[model samples]
Target: MKGVEIRLQVQYRARVDESIEACHARFTAGMQQFGPPFGWQDLEPPPAPYIKPASGDMIGVEWFRYPIKGLKLQITAQHRHELSIGTDKDTSDDRLSIEFKTSNKALDYRAILREHFPKLIEAYRGYRAWAVFDYYGGRYTDWNWGPWLGREATNPSYQRLCKEPGVDIDGRNNIFTLEPAVFWDNELCRRALGYGPEEVMRRLQGHALSVQPLLDGVYVVFDDDPALTYERFLEINKQFKELLGIA
Candidate 1:
């Protein structure tokens, strides 16, 4: 289904301890303007080992699943001490708030919001948070997009390369270039491949073809592997590459 991605950056002057609660109140109030039976539920905290810091830091995130519209919303508030407080020792705080919304009837939703939540719309205009909501009316598939065994550093560098294209040898703006090309001194490759300098040198000495790291944690094999065999790697890589390319 068609949808719109709405991003709002919000700024607030408040105390660090109160920022979270204040944000919650603002969001709840905004949601209330949308009317009842909207069905809001908090998403589980990012699965364990990936849990974000809960300390008094910048950007407190709250995720919600909107049952009525089947939309996902992320509310993020970032504490800005420098801007809010004149000096480092000062306790005053400011927050950058962001919200994202996606929905099938985007125009209608926007009109409804503008008419019912004028303050929220106004807040969105000057807010400084990194919030965005993407509503899609389509099925989502599960696909792994993380580093694989022996390729820890690969994904990060690939992401960087994708972001800034000069580092790519093929000039394709794609990290896959690094896959066939030798790792050289790229740190991401080292992390993803999970090999130290010495180990990388040793492996390259014997292998004719090596795995190419791609964005979203997939790899490509350009050369044939006889000893360890690249088939398994190629198979898994192809699967993810296809999965990620799908809309």
Candidate 2:
């Protein structure tokens, strides 16, 4: 089992009204405040020599890895950062994800998450509107796409195994969108909100909703209207904690 790397990725999605430029600026300002002691120093866009797109809804951004410190263990956590811009149907989608990759066997994943969850939550103060409290990724992005092709009268997920993107499903009066946890394995380290599209939209009305339940127990909630705000999202997260053992 040599060279088998284990990494933990945590993310959350946010709906923003700002353009890519504005969103990047906000991220840049925060970049100087990540990590311990001081945070990422000498942070800047990719040096001119080897610059290329990092893929998906990225208008512009710089990449850096903040070394996790203060852990009195053999494991090393190199936290990779992504400030991306994307789109959700018409709403601007922004993503921020911190991935911790380690080869150390002494580290406990839950302990690492619990230690950083509060800091991560506090870091996302300014851009909370339509901000989903659960870990999904993004504070921005233009990757506007859905996860389904068509909604039949019945959802096939009730039967059979599904493991791909853009599959047709039952959409009758139901909202079909991409299931959260961009990488299913990535969700293993996340604190799930467990709220389906119907439930999320239903809680904060003024929008049509649909849900495509997955056999994996994860779900995709399609919000016909992205009007949920950060305050409302916070409220929802609080309720999620109360109703479900999300945290």
Candidate 3:
């Protein structure tokens, strides 16, 4: 996993009937709780871009400056929403992507994972979301085009390629995930999903790196060791499947 860097992703549905401005405001307020100087730069260039707190449209950013050791965050937003609004209308899923790179050779990514990962998870209040820290979890790269020609390198094909080894093809066999997290979020205790967050914590008691409760979910760190490999991740995911009986 030389080229593979640790990625953090959180996926959830947008609030019912929430405008982009309202959504943006709520998001920024929550993130700001992580404290000042952790602010976003609107990537959508202004004739006046959406810069106002919580009341702007189509806000985007490439880097968010965080206070930890001058670690500039690479932020990507994939929240797709339509103009129509109603209680009956289904909200679209939104995602925030962050990355920790090897460029800062002086700092250990694992140390960052240990310290700020949960705080970052707490900073976002999504309707229903799951945050995860994994190597290449659902990101696109040249690997998709490496093996196939023009048509096959499309998004769906790339997703299938990323998922095939760690997940069942139909995407239902184990929690709708591909590369599972070394650190992950479980929102709302997931009672409807048949496993309580505490139960997962109990089951993974000794084996897990760390498991902490969030306001509405649980944060799990699978392994913190420097030697963790992709193959080892698959093994831990197998253990996860068995412990939760989701496989």
Candidate 4:
């Protein structure tokens, strides 16, 4: 079966203690939601004797696996912080500040993200937590909000799509594209552009979707059908390997 793997990054900010507690709470809550009695395991520490460059600084790592809609979801959390006070005497205050980071491996399902994510977001909103969906495959592989939302005028065609009605372009849209390709007949592209088949193909071939690089690999988003999307993914994967000098 053809499928896509996703990697997500969730960051939560709050009083150091509160953030840590919130992370723990999330893990417990997620496990219960999945109806599994999963447990968190500590990741191996950095090579032993890891000398600390500073005092009152620490790091913690933990991993948990749970079932979500019949798919195994692996969630990892990392906490890093320092205990110190600001050097500025006026604004200086001694307090423990921490950063909470979490991520998950994709689950085997058409749509792993049910209403759970919205609930999770709401639960952590008090701590100013934000979840980012790093879509790997599908029609959104190559889409990126950074440059599109930025002031750059690189791809005029894509820019036009952003401006089109019924197409939400706001940062809050949360929609992204991976390594997407344009095919001769993509209904989504046709509808989004309000163009005929010939025009759609012309625009697509004339301007390919943008490419974005992830940690392990790169993806592109295109105005192509699902079958074509998979084909283009293979093509880009080959090109990426060649560029990396990988056999």
Distance (Å) between predicted and true CA of 202, model 2? 19
Write the residue-wise lDDT of candidate 3 on 122-222 in tens digits.
55553233323343333222233344443333245445545655432212223433333322334333522466667767877776776666655666666
- TM-score for all models, in order of appearance: 0.31, 0.33, 0.61, 0.32
lDDT by candidate, in order shown: 0.33, 0.30, 0.47, 0.31
Off by over 4 Å in 1: 1-4, 14-18, 26-30, 33-57, 79-84, 87-103, 106-110, 116-247
Against the true structure, whose lDDT is highest? 3
| Residue-by-residue lDDT tens digits, candidate 2, 1-247 | 2212222322224334333444344544654566542233454432211223464332333444444442221111111233233322212223344443233344433333333333333343222212122222121111222457442333233233134333222111112222211121112212223444344334433321322222222222222122334345334434433433332
Q: Taking the tens digit of each residue's C-alpha lDDT, what string does model 1 give over 1-247? A: 4444544323333443444555455555544444422322342222111114556454445555544354444554545332343332112323233233334442244332323223333332221122222311010111223445232233343445446624332221222322211222233334333443344334433333333222212222223221212344444335533432311
Q: Where in model 4 is the C-alpha error above 4 Å?
A: 17-19, 30-59, 67-111, 120-247
Off by over 4 Å in 2: 1-17, 37-61, 67-92, 105-108, 124-247
Q: Could you tell me the TM-score of candidate 2?
A: 0.33
TM-score of structure candidate 4: 0.32
Name the weakest run of 10 consecutive residues (lDDT summed) in model 1.
Answer: 135-144
**C-alpha-based local distance difference test score of model 2:** 0.30
Clashing pairs counted in every model: 33, 32, 2, 21
